[model samples]
Target: MLKHVQVRSSSSLLRPGGQKADTLSINSNMSFCSLHEPALSSRSSSYTSLNETQSSTGSASVPAAPPTTTVKVYTRCLRPDLEYKTMSVKYTTTCRDLVDQLLNKYRMKHRDPNLFFLTMEVATRSTGTAVRTILVLDDDSCPAQLQACYPRADSKFTVRMRHGGLVKVYDSVLMAESQYKSLLVSDRTSVDQLVQLLLTCYKSNESVHNYSLYEVCRTTSFERKLHADDRPLAIQQEWSSLAEYSFVLMKRPPGTPRSGRDFPLRRSFLQWSRNRELASWSGREISVIEERRSKSHRSPSLSLAPARKEGEKSFYI
Candidate 1:
């Protein structure tokens, strides 16, 4: 049976340690040898294929980088000419990014980047009647998101010097009677600088010398005034204090003597008459009548007057 089982041997498989066993198995059964040869070859091919597949998978595992996006924006300087500027930035670019770019570009052209910042006036309503100027904060979102707040696409913006602050709406007689000037002052501006701003409206020659910032409060229609310390950004507290605030610019007449307090209690004829009438309605009212005369009275005369009857006329003897 071994003589009849003639097997072809491969020199590569005929190693000194392994050929004898292979030959013996082949010689034992010819049909079994044929099936075993294919199995051995298939095992080697499958191993090589697995190694190639692993290498291919290893190279493919590194993820590809995601793409970036950019957007274009336009800016206008709030000036006589309304100078225009254009910029292209990333989708996630912020106010700081645009401001820095603008500063650099402006410096290149005009050679001055100091105090300039990006700003835009956003309309408060759909009818485009009123608008508020908002300083583009560093952390604020991109122009696309800002458009949602502003709503008007054609609305222009400005790159101006930081020079103003927000003042709260107060319902005082002075504020109601006078034209409401929205004072937007820079945080770095001094009280003296604010006095200069007030001078523009009042246009008094003595404004620079006499005008000063005051802490003015009116409780029950009695106006109380205090001299505010002169400092840079003195009214910073009032700058953001939307409601609870009492600050005013008062222009004292030239050579007019001021007491310990800036605004003294001296009633005019009308104010005195009004006070008298109001006191009569209250039945019994103690009144401090401050009578002041120019040069005649060195100081105001303060006298406490007892409540009089409706028909009584008192004499100062």
Candidate 2:
């Protein structure tokens, strides 16, 4: 009788620790020795394929960072002195974005973004005179792109408060003689609001209604009182190119109309009076007068009073 047998070789099978065993089995019709070898190779290939797929998928999902640029921003509106700050921003950063960054850097994040803007100052020498032209950039405009437009001129970027312009506010009552405050204003800000702001800045307990804002032009020697509903910023912008304008805050004159016809003479008189008062009370004169007054007030009748020096005289004599 013919008998059928099966044989298996342990050398081709993966043992518990992936070691080859010294055992064999024989099969007459088929060979089972390489059966486990294919299974192990297939599993390894599938695992390698899975790891590659995972790596490719992870690399494809992540995004690359955009390019950045460095810019210098001059900030003159935040303080009396000019300041410049350097920042790292994206090339596509807009004027509005730069303004926000500047405000945040200066610890003024709580302020309104609309109150500030970016400007480009182009300084050129024309007709042997130095001329400067300031152009206000739109909020959507890109600062980095605009800077590239002017390659030869001395151009600089500055952050300014969105005002008609910088106006000098003279408050003779609150401030010292010939001293004034610089204020930034918007075109829509009215005289009443400006007066209130000035009062708040000076920390005065006076009523806003009692004060009036006057526009004084030194070049034209003209003066006018601004109405409550009048926009001082707009007026300033209009007269900006024509003359040097300043704002004067003072008490509202009684029985006087808002025409401001006689205000100039009144202002002059007030200035003269102030000058006279200042001239009459000089530092040396004040000290001498104070000394005489102190001596006259001292009691000469006191027996404990020390005798006067050789050159000194008693107030009673």
Candidate 3:
């Protein structure tokens, strides 16, 4: 006789003190600005004239325009084909203005500018160890100024989609074979809701109960089976790097026990969710299974191999 397995909904989870998850809050008032290129030639001429006048008379020269920095912003959530865009930004450039420039560069139209936001990846040294962390920048925050503060540390900027919050989801069984799909969600959006959205995107008619979502880190070989009541977007925001870790959709192993006792409260995440501080999950290291090489490539010496092997897997599932 087969024993039936019980399933729990996302709403059943409780907070630290036994409270419900917070309501969804989406920011739809993000304003768009037109791109305005600074006239460098005119500024140079003005500076040259000021230097001549200063030489002729012992008068003080005026300060030049704010210095600008060249930066590249990558975006896989908006359009996968278009990887990144480069532009010049001054110390006063805000995150909102950066998004406007990217949209203009891509010539994207009819899309709500409110659904996009910027995130930065910073690598800092602590106790002689390198630590990388991702930060979701605010509309009023200045990326150029922030980079200047961390001149010694490595910094990278990426434009991500976020209404409530945008999360990248993978549908493959292996990391090498996975391709990401972006979904808009909030802290209130449960794992169950994410599964439904993925189902609709993939056009799968399978039972939602038969599936499970796992947070997998390919670099560390660490994976955690997320609870049905878990908020995926909130979990993603707590991660260190999107490239090293991601949410993967997989089939639930048969007869796997289900319970909410092991899951943390969604409200607890609010304490460190969007803060500027760094957060990383520490899990026991696990061993990875290496793929076997063919006889022709058995030798451990260098050889002129094709860019992609004949049997290599595709990026998409």
Candidate 4:
């Protein structure tokens, strides 16, 4: 959607007594000032005469550069369920303006205007490195208009609620033990936040202090575990990039051996299941007999084989 902001007039003229004349006035939505051209021409002539006088008197007047409204930015909400909103904002638009617009478009029941904050999720041009989420300070202008923040591409901004003692987080995906959980986390949530969220979701008797978060990334051959760090944005970025992001709870550091007793029970159970499945299979199983019968019928027989080829000897095995 396109939204236009009105610009103040910059056209001024010089008066007869070495004073400035009234500034030119334009309508709010005026594409061009349609005032009498003759009046404008007279004002320009007077302004130019004053400039000539200034140059002859060894003083020069420098015209002020007109303010620009060239920047138009597109912003999207991080909320998956909400319809994505793309707005064209002026370069002079403040962060507060964008935040208000976002809130108005998607009303948040618990969001406090005073506590609202905006953050940007940034990624490098290359896929080798992970994305970074940086806080958008309210006092700062919109990063979308700044070339330094996003040099080659546009970034999505996320809304966060911050109270004196509490933080409102964005939507995040967390997986554990073959179960998927979508939860909201506090801004800049660390390992503690993950553990707390897990404890609440699972209703586990274990204390949060006793738990440690270990990230698990899987490959075709095997799974690798990395120690979860305290960086919230880093973790959020990793979660956003992955199709399936999960963390496991381990009593010890990853790669440590499990208790011997548990392993025997698990192994015996798996073996028993395998044996039971094999025993349940019928001898007439189509896959097993079909290929075998095909091979047997195709076997070359000494007596039934074709007669010896011309100039070739026939052998019996």
RMSD of 1: 20.3
Computed on alpha carbons, the lDDT of every model, listed in order, comes to: 0.47, 0.66, 0.66, 0.47
**Best of the two (1, 2) by TM-score:** 2
Better of 2 and 3 by TM-score: 2
Candidate 3 segments exceeding 4 Å error:
1-63, 164-317
How would you encode candidate 4's per-residue C-alpha lDDT over 1-317 as one tens digit per residue? Answer: 12346546553677888677666555454343536456667788999999988887774356645344333233333356654466556666667776666656665423334445666656654567656656465636654566345744545555665532332222222233334444454444455555565555555666555545444433211222223335333444534235443444544435543222221221222233234444655665535644655878753222222234576521110
- Point to the candidate with the largest lDDT: 2
Residue-level lDDT tens digits of model 1 in 1-317: 12355566455455666654333335544443544477767887999999999999998997865333333334444333435666656556666567667656655322123245555555554575665556564436565455545445544455656554544222222334764445555555455555555554444445455654444334212233333333323343522232433555555657854334422233222234345655655333422233323435443322333444576532210
Best by TM-score: 2
Query: How do the predictions measure up, each by TM-score?
Result: 0.28, 0.37, 0.33, 0.26
Off by over 4 Å in 1: 1-23, 26-82, 106-114, 126-141, 148-155, 163-317
Better of 1 and 3 by lDDT: 3
- lDDT tens digits, residue span 177-246, model 3: 5487787666666887778767755566777777887777675455667778878867787665678778
